[model samples]
Every structure is written in C-alpha cells, then in structure tokens.
Target: MKTRKKILVACGTAIATSTVVARKIEEELEKRGIAVETTQCKASEVPSKAEGHDLIVATTFVSGAGDIPVIQTVSFLTGVGIEADIDRIISYIEGA
Candidate 1:
C-alpha cells in the first residue's frame, strides 16, 4: 500500500478558516486518490508542529518551518487561484 502524505494546514486560530481550507484540500486530494493526513494548527505553532509533515499550507506567513515546503495562500477561502494551489499540493504529493 502507498503511504499517506502528512499535511499541515494552519491559520491564525486553527478553527474557521483553516477548517475550510483543510476540507477543500482533503476533498481535492481524495478525488485524486492521494491519501493524506491533515493536521490543523495555528500558524504560530507550525515550527514545532510541522516536524513530520510533508507540506505546510498556511493562510498566513509561517517562518521557521525548516525545509518543509510552505505554501502561504488564502485562495482556498477566497476562491481565487485555488486550482493552482491544489496543483502545487498535488505536485508535492506526486514528487513524494
């Protein structure tokens, strides 16, 4: 079986906005049959919380994420360039 990709979806509060973005990412990845485990957390927690994550998708800037690929985007909520963002996520999954 293929291993699932671990994703970190972070925002300010890790509630409302992150929830929406995480759901969208889950749906998109599910459609592509790319299994993923998403963890929601505050952007501020990303540095420590992103230890084993394959990717970091955040609604705000997140520094100190080490070598993790951080995609700072709000398009999932704004409905703008969302596909591009998803494509980026897919690329990472594909590369992995």
Candidate 2:
C-alpha cells in the first residue's frame, strides 16, 4: 500500500464545501489506518488539478479525471451514505 494517498476534494468553490469534505475524508480514512493528503480545489479546476492525485472526491459534477478515479457525491455534507462513500474512496485508492 502507498504510505499516503493524494485526494482532490472539490466543490463549487475552493473554500467552504471542499474544506468540509476534505476533513471528513481524512478523518474517516485515518480511522481505517489509511493516510491521505488532500487538496481543495474548485470543481471547475478538477481537470487541470487531477493529474497527480490518487482520487477525486467532488461535491459537484466533474469530468476529465482521465485514468484517475472520481467519486462525485454530496453525502459528506448531507451526512448520508458517507460511510459507503469512504469505503468506495478506499477501494479506489487501494486499487491504485
């Protein structure tokens, strides 16, 4: 396994929503003994910013992630199905 995974967390803007999602991803993954480094970016920036990242978690729609995996969901903010999403995120990272 990689020592640390890179996750791109994006929302409508680069600030508020991404912060919340990034923190949630980090915390949940840490609890599972997975370490992650997160970058917060605007949804519009995903295509340009996704190259180096292991996974992309977006609160809004995003395309152009290429070979990297992308999970677009708002469950982190809505507090619904977040556990499943975390597991999904882990699967992608572990597979990578």
Candidate 3:
C-alpha cells in the first residue's frame, strides 16, 4: 500500500481564520484519501512546527525554515488560488 502523506497547515495566528483554513485543507485532503496532520500556529512558528512533516503549508509568507517542501498561499475562502495551490502541494507530495 502507498504511504500516507503528512502535511502541516499554519497561519499567522492560531485562531479563527487559520483554524478555518486548516479544516478546509484537512477536508479536501481527506476527500482524496490522503492522510494529513494539521496544526494552526503563528507564522513565526511554522518552520519549527514543520518537523517530520512531508509538507508545510502557510497562509502567509515564511522563509528559511523547514527543509521540507513548503506551500505559501492565502486563505482558501478566497477561492481564487486554492485549486492551484492544492494541486502544487499534492504534486509535491506525490513526487511528481
């Protein structure tokens, strides 16, 4: 069987909108049968929190932190960049 992919979702704050974005990512990933682990954290904490994760996703800009692949995107609520962002994440995880 294929291994499940682990993902980290982080934001500038660990409340409200960040939580919502994390949930949306979890839901979307789960629908595809991909295993995801999400955490809402301050943007500054993302690099540290991303340890052992296959991918790190941030709602805001973050740099020079985790060694894993990272995706920087806006909230999914905007519905503008979500699909492309998600596709990039999945492709990265799938080693595409």
lDDT, model 3, position 32: 79
Worst 10-residue lDDT window for candidate 3 reads 58-67
Model 2 regions lying over 4 Å from their true place: none
- For model 2, residues 35-85, the per-residue Cα lDDT tens digits are 899999998898899999989999999888888888999999999999999
Which candidate order results from sorting by TM-score in descending order?
Answer: 1, 2, 3
Q: In angstroms, how far off is 86's CA in candidate 1?
A: 0.9
**Model 3: per-residue Cα lDDT over 2-96, one tens digit each:** 76677777677767667888888878877878766676777788766777777777778876554788777774868787778777878988882
Worst 10 residues of 1 by lDDT: 28-37
RMSD in Å for all candidates:
0.9, 1.2, 2.0
The lDDT for every candidate, in the order shown, is: 0.90, 0.91, 0.75
Better of 2 and 3 by lDDT: 2
TM-score of each: 0.95, 0.94, 0.81
For each candidate, how many residue pairs have backbone atoms clashing (under 3 Å)? 0, 0, 0
Q: Is candidate 2 or candidate 3 better by TM-score?
A: 2
lDDT of 1 by residue, 1-96 (tens): 978899999999998999999999999888977779899999889888989999999999888899889899999999999889989998987786
